[model samples]
Target: MENTESRNTAFEDIGQRISKAAKASRRSVSDIELVAISKTRTADEIRPLLDRGHRVFGENRVQEAAGKWPELRQDYADVELHLVGQLQSNKAADAVELFDAIHSIDRLSLVKALAKAMDKLDRRIPCFVQVNIGEESQKGGCAIEDTASLISQAQAAGIKVAGLMCVPPSNVSPAPYFALLAKLAKGNGLKGLSMGMSGDFESAIMLGATHIRVGTALFGERSSAG
Candidate 1:
């Protein structure tokens, strides 16, 4: 577990870094949102950051988030949860109910399922079309060539298409991939770029990333699979 003083300090340091990067890119610091990925972290480990008033968090699995956040949100009114992993069609309704934003709308089937779920529930959660910017076969995102079509389908179904999200190929310079995701968002008239992580967030901010998902830096390191 992390002490309160260190957790506060880490949060502030990341905030300062975000401000500097946003300024260097000629963008407003307020325009960028820092989503502290809390997947695999326990509520005891997460409460200190929440105590510091950081409300936005990212979780990879709906079941894990459901176990923790329903109670947390009851305690903190401002909490905003983001689904940052590939969502299954079967879990669309549950995801729609739990997450304030969904960042992995990558396929036509998912788009259709989420749309129906939102309609049935009467909630309109914002969505980000995850793009396979690196074109990796094992990864879970729409191929770059199919992004526009997915966006159109999402919009037509009344889903609030917030922007684009991507995880660039690992162990490589991610700047170009970040830049490409930014370009794709701009070309498609989207605003949010959910591209950076703990390692390359500064570069992502410079490349017009509106949202960054930082896990390890904020939470020290995850202990086990959730």
Candidate 2:
């Protein structure tokens, strides 16, 4: 676990980096949202960031978030949680109940499930249709060619399609992938681009990533025990 002082310093450093990237791109710093990826981190591990006034976070699993956030939100009521991993259709209701935003809407089944869940709960949850930007067989995102249709389908189902999200192929320059996502969002008449990570977020910001999901840079590498 990271000590409070180191965590605070890291948090501030990330904020400064984001500001610099946003300015370099001629974009507003306020427009880029930094979603601290908190999956696999315990509540105690996350509390220090909250103490530092950081609120937005991303979790990979609905069940993991359910285990912690309800209790944590009791104290930090304004905390915004985003689901940033592959979501199964069966968990749509639980996700609709918890996450402030969903960034992995990739398939029609998931979209329909989310739409049904939102209607049942009477809560409109914003979603980012994940695009398999690198065309990786192992990753979870809608195929690049299917992105437009997915966004349209999500909107027609009453799901608030916020934008698009993607994880570029690892060990390569991510700038092109980020640019492609931005272009795709613009083509679909969307604004949010949820791309970037701890390692490449600066490039992502320069290429117009509206939201960056950072984990190891904020929380440090996860222990083997996790």
Residue pairs clashing in model 1 are none
For each candidate, the alpha-carbon lDDT, in order, equals 0.93, 0.95
Give per-model TM-scores. Answer: 0.97, 0.98
User: Lowest lDDT 10-mer window, candidate 1?
Assistant: 217-226
List clashing residue pairs in candidate 2: none
Alpha-carbon RMSD of each model: 1.3, 1.0
Model number with the top TM-score: 2
| Overall local distance difference test of candidate 2 | 0.95
lDDT of 1 by residue, 1-226 (tens): 4366777888999999999998899999999999999998888888999998888999999999999999988889789999999899999999999999999998999999999999999999999999999999999889999999999999999999999999999999999999999999999999999999999999999998999999988877655563
Residue-level lDDT tens digits of model 2 in 1-226: 4377788888999999999999898999999999999999999899999998999999999999999999999999999999999999999999999999999999999999999999999999899999999999999999999999999899999999999999999999998999999999999999999999999999999998889999999888889998
Best by lDDT: 2
